[model samples]
Target chain A: MIRFDRASKRYPNGREALSGATFEIREGEMVFLTGRSGAGKSTVLKLIALLERPTRGLVMVNGCNTAALASRRIPAFRRQLGVVFQDHRLLTERSIFDNVALPLHAAHAPLKDIDKRVRAALDQVGLLDRAQALPLELSVGEQQRVGIARAVVVKPKLLIADEPTGNLDPALSMEVMGLFRRFNEVGVTVVIATHDIDLVKASGLREIIVADGKVQDPATEKLVVPSMEAER
Target chain B: MSGWLLRHVQSALFAAGRLARAPVSTAFTVLVIAIALTLPTALALGIHSVRSSTGEFANAVDVSVYFKRDVPIEKARQLAASLRQRSGIARVEFIAADEALKQFREQSGFGAALDVLEGNPLPHALDVRPKTDAADPAHMESLRRYIAAWPEVELVQIDSDWVKRLNAILDLLRRLVLGASALLGVGVLAVVGNTIRLEIYSRRAEIEVTKLVGGSNAFVRRPFLYTGLLYGVAGALLAALLAWTALQLLDAPVARLAQSYGSSFRLLAPGWRELGILLGVGALLGVLGAWLAAARHLARIEPRS
Candidate 1:
């Protein structure tokens, strides 16, 4: 569950990454944030993840105001949701299992529970056999899956990803998209930001188009329509 | 509680593993800390040994009251007896002129020369030892004046100036030791802090990732704190070992030197209390340094993407 009320972000270098961008996503929905490069999709995700606060207006994720949340409380707030980056963000020196078990460790989960959950998350991503392999030793897709496994290891209710399929082949990209679809099928709300219009069209998910640091009006925007409108 | 302890143990082991992976750098860092600690610890122990060896000399201050050569041995004995009744005088022993000459002849190896001389030239004297509490310079001076005013006394000499000078030198050395310990303690802190800073810098990527994945500042800092603590603890242990070895190497030579002085003084090894302090200080400084470095740098490394 995420809601943005005219959220604006201006970086320290005076770059306005987002301006009055407002949107809402209901629970249990998988949505794609479609935007060109530097079109503010990542900014939206950053705001949602509390990596950067909004310069103006309001952004809420899982009932906590991202702009007003205390910095000390940010870690606990982040544990309620998962974030996957385009670069995988895995510790290269550690094994795939260690990388995936990070979130559980961060949460101070029991060692036994951490081992079991890590294995389970890796199994879901089809990388159970590569548990002990380092991130650099794995294929790029497998590395990204390991990142996904890490993100989901804590069983966060909302999962947000930024350009996760950016470096993958179209086939691999679709496969990664299918993994997201599987998680969504089990009632995990997912938000993915991407510029892959083809992938967005093929996935047939609800699309939020952002341009020029603003969210486009869905009614008149020239993009893929929401196919699950009747359910909404 | 067990889970909490397990996490701490895990962090400690992880920190140790990281240091082990970079053995050369870690060893160099620890050596610097040990050297810094060793100087102060050795100096402190040396001061302790010096103080203990000179304990008797520090407490005793004696004066000699020599009577005029014309004074009779009977008058000298009466004067010594009266001096013993004084408030500040601890003991008084009358030495007859003949006895003094005999002692001088035996100790100075002047027997053949003295055999050719006429009658004994030494005067009767009283060896006066003052009470420990009245051995201060002013008190000794006043006591000497009191004895010099005696009609039959020719000289009243307080043989305590050298003792006072020795105590002054010891006091100066004690201050120097205190100053050096404080400065070297700061040096230890700086060494550990800088090492931890570099460690944090090298692991910046891991820190960012951990923080990104819901890791608290405390969680991210746990390993670095443990790393600092290990460095401090290991350094202290090595310093103790080094100090022990140095004492062993110097013990025989020191004993021989003391023997030359007709003293049985031996160098004292560091005791359990000193060892405990070294370890405790090392661990405390290590934790403090790591905490400082982490507090300064960790919060600035937010995940950008």
Candidate 2:
């Protein structure tokens, strides 16, 4: 589960990236953060990942206030969640298998477990046959799939992706969404940030739109300024 | 626990593989380290051999106390007996005027010329050998001054001047060796640090990706640390080989030179313990350089949200 209560983040340059943005999502739910570029959606995900902290208010994940989490514990906190980037972030020098096995390797998993789990995740992304191929040799779509496989390879309880399909065609994007849907069906919570309204509409998942450093309700698509009543 | 061990092993092997893949660059780096390390090692060995050779000469340090020609042989014998009991004098031999004449005739090969003299002109003398610890110039001088102040003594000659000069030269050589080793040590650290810096730069993207995937700073640094360690170890082995070869080349020439000098002194080779220390220092410097480079560069790289 994820919760952000009146959370705000300001950059060192005096630019407010997120201002009193608030939301909550229960376990095993798939949610989309639809926003324009630089709308602070990524910032929100970053706070949950403990890659960044809010300058004001509180952000909580799995009942732990991230603001209070010591810096030394950030790695363990991050291990419980998976993050995917728009660029796929695959190591071009390594094989797809090695790329997918990275998260497990970071966790110091056993070799046998790493191999089995990496294969299973690759299989889920339907790229099991290309495990030996290099990331540079794969198509853009296949590379993105490899990234997805890497993210879920750790079996993180929460999966947060920042514009994972920003570079894919609509068909490929839909396929990626379906893969995430499958992971969600298997009880993995998924939160994706994207500007793709068409994809969000087709997926029919819970959407929280963000614009101008504020979270807006999906039904009305209007800014829900943090109110004292909503602070509860 | 096994998994952790496996990861460390894997990281080390992976680091070695990465370096091995670039053989030419690795070889060049190792050569630089070896050369830097060998210079000081060779100098130190040179100083050690010289010190030991001079040490052998120091063992025979003696001060000759010649009695006045008017002094009686019985008085010289009494002085010798008294000097024998002194703490710093290892041995005292009394040489009467007649015995001194005999020795001069035999050693100078002037027996016919000496037999024509009316009376033995040689003075009664005492040859006093100093203890090993009192064989240096200052100790010998002090002993000479003490003997010259005696009533019957005509002259006191300390025969440790050459030893003192050799010791002074050896002291300078030792200091030079120490300074050169320290400078070369810093050079080794810089070589390793620069190599690691370049490695971090080339793999900047890999580092960023690793961090984003929940890899801790230590995890990200593991490979680079191993890379430095391998470089250091490889460099140390090569330096040992180089030093051995150098000693081998010098061994025959030095033996021949010592033969010409009528002394049998051989060049000293580094023992196993010294080699082990060289390897340990190399490895330690490698790790330190890698840690410094990684800690500085890794902090600058963060996964952009």
Candidate 3:
């Protein structure tokens, strides 16, 4: 479960990234946050990940207040949630297997467990055979899948992705969203931040619309309506 | 517990693999460190040789106590006998006035001139050889001062001025070696720190990804620390080898020179103790350098959330 209770974040340079935004999502729920560039969607996810602290209100992840988490405990706190980036931030020098095994390595999991989970995660992303290949050798979509596999390799309770399909074509984006759907089906809470209104509606999931550093009412936001494509 | 151990071993192995991937650069770095360390080691060996030579001449550093002209040979003999019982004095040989004059005539080639004198001109004296440990110039000087204070003794001459001068030279060389070693130590640290900084810079993206995925700062730093450690150890071993080879090349000539001087002293190669100390210093510097670089740079690289 994730909750942001009127949380606000202000950059040091007098830019308000988030302004008293409040939201709550139930356990095992998949949610999409829609906002234009610099609308503070990423800031919300960052607060949840304990990467940044809220300037005013409390931010909670899995029933724990992230503001109270010490810097020394951030790594352990981060291990509980998987995060995907828009850039597909895979270590180019390492093989796909090594990249995916990174989380387990960070946790100091047993080597055998790392091998088994890495293979399983790679298989989930349909890239098990490409585990030995470097990220640079893969297509952009494939590299993004590897990133996804890496994020989920630790079986984190919640997964947050920031414009994960921003670099993909429409079909590839759909495929990436489908992968998230599958993860959500298996009781993994998923939250995605994207500006793609059509893609958010097509999934027929709960939508939280952010605009101008504040969350818009879900009923009044036209982009939150289910799409005709979803009805089909 | 076993998993943690395995992770550390894996990180160390990974560092070695990275070094192995770039053999030429790594070799060059190691060579630089070895050369830096070799100068100090060779200088220390030279100082050690000088110290050993000084030790060999310790027994010859005796004090000559001369009695006043009015002091009788019987009184001087009694003084010598009493000096022989002292702790630091190893032996006391009394020379009667007539015997002293005879020796002076034989050595000084003034036989007819000395025979011209009505009475023996040379005073009775005691040649005092100090115990081996007390034969250093400083201790010898102290013994000379103690003897000069005697009521019957007119003067005490210590035959250790040249030895004192040699010791001063050795001391200066030791200080120079220490200074050189400290400077080279800083050089080694800088070399390692720069290398690690570059490595960290090149791998900045990888480090960011590692941190994003829950890797602790210690985990991210482990490999670089190991890299620094390996660099230090390899350099130390190479320096030891190089110093040993140089000593071998010089040993024959040094032995011959000593032989020509009718001395049996030989060059001393560094033993295990010296090697251990060198290796320890190298490793410590390596770790310190890496830690400094990592601490300075790693914090600035938080993942962009």
Candidate 4:
């Protein structure tokens, strides 16, 4: 679960990235964050990840106020969450297997268990055959899948993806979304930030539409689900 | 794999293997460190050699007590005889004024120059050697005062200046070695820092990804720190080799020099204690350099996500 209670973020140069914003993400929910550029979409995820603290109000992740935790403990806290970047930030120097095994290694997982789990996770994203292949040698879609395998390899309770399909074709995007749907079906909470309205419309998941640093709609007072079906 | 020590050592060795993948650069860096470490080690050996040699010279000490010309040779002989019997006295020789004059005339090449002198101008003297314990500068001064104040003694010439000068040189050498080692240690640190920095720069993206995956700063710095330790250990070994080789190169000539002075002294490498200190200090410096580099750079790099 994640909470941004009346949170706001302001850059030092006086740019208001997020202002007086709020939302709650419950357990095992698959939510889509649909917003335009500079609409605080990435900033929202960053707040939950403890990569950046909010300027005003509290940001809580899994019940702990992240702003108050010691900087050193942040890494352990982060290890509990799986994050997939839009750039498919796979370590290009290593094979797909090693890249996926990295999170387990950070946790100091046992060697045999790590090998088994990494193989199993790679199998989930359909990258098992490419396990020995380096990221540079993989196609873009395959590399993104490697990123997904790496993120979920640790069996994180929360998964955050920022534009997972930003560079994929329509077919690849749909496939990736289906893969995320499968993870969510297995009780892994997912929040994806994207500008892809068409993909959001097709996915039929709960959507939170943010614009100009604020969520729009009457549901904003309670929960702005961003679901047009609710309005109907 | 978790509790196995071989795993850690294997990882460390694997990390070192990565360094060896670029053999030329690794060799060059190790060579530079070795040379840096060797200079101070060689200086230490040299200082040790000088100290021991001059220590041997410290044994060549004596007291020259001059008697009044009117003192009878019999009186001077009695003084010498009893001085030799003193607890710490090694030997005491009596030289009557005539005997001194005869020896001077025999050795002075100007044999007739002393014949022009009247009444055996030189005074009868006693050359006294004390026990080694009483040969120190302070104790020698005390003995000189004690002997010169004797009724039969007119003057005492205990030439401690050469010994004092040698001691001063030894002290200066010690200070010089310390100063040089300190300076070179800084150089070693700088070398390690720069090496770690370059490694960090090359692996910057890897570090970013690691941090993003929730790797601690300690995790990211582990390999680089190992690399520095490796450098230090390798450099220390190389320095030991260089020091031994230098001693070997100087051994024959040094032995000849010793023989010229009626000695059997030989050039020797550092003893075990000094070797241990060298190895330990080198590794410590390596660790320190890596720590400094890691503290400065790892804090600045953040996860891009």
Best by TM-score: 1
**What is the per-residue lDDT of model 4 for residues A44-84, given as tens digits with 9 covering 90 to 100?**
88888888888898898988898898999988988899999
Which CAPRI tier for candidate 2? Answer: medium
Residue A106 lDDT (model 4): 79
> Candidate order by lDDT, highest to lowest?
1, 3, 2, 4
Scanning candidate 2 chain B in windows of ten residues, the lowest lDDT window is B53-62
Could you tell which candidate, 1 or 3, scores higher by DockQ?
Answer: 1
lDDT of 1 by residue, B1-305 (tens): 69999899999999999999999999999999999999989888888898888888877988988899999888888888888889988899888989889999987888999999899889898889998889888898999999999999999887777877888898899999999989998998889999988888888899889988999999999999999999999999999999989999999999999998778988899989999999998899899989998899888888788
RMSD of 1: 3.7
Tell how far residue A55 is off in model 1, in angstroms.
1.1
lDDT of each: 0.89, 0.87, 0.88, 0.84
DockQ, cand. 4: 0.59
Model 4 residue pairs with clashes: none
Ranking of candidates on TM-score, top first: 1, 4, 2, 3
User: By DockQ, who's the top model here?
Assistant: 1
Model 1 TM-score, all chains together: 0.91
> Which lDDT tens digits does candidate 1 get at residues A79-168?
889899999999999999999989899999988899999999999999999999999999999999998999988998899999999999
Residue A154, model 4: lDDT of: 89
> What are the clashing pairs of model 1?
none
Model 3 ranges with Cα > 4 A deviation: A217-232, B56-61, B64-89, B92-127, B131-156
In the range A46-79, model 2's lDDT, one tens digit per residue, is 8988888999998989888999998667767778
Docking category of candidate 1: high
How do the candidates score on chain B by TM-score? 0.88, 0.80, 0.76, 0.81
DockQ-better candidate, 2 vs 3: 3
Candidate 2 clashing pairs? Answer: none
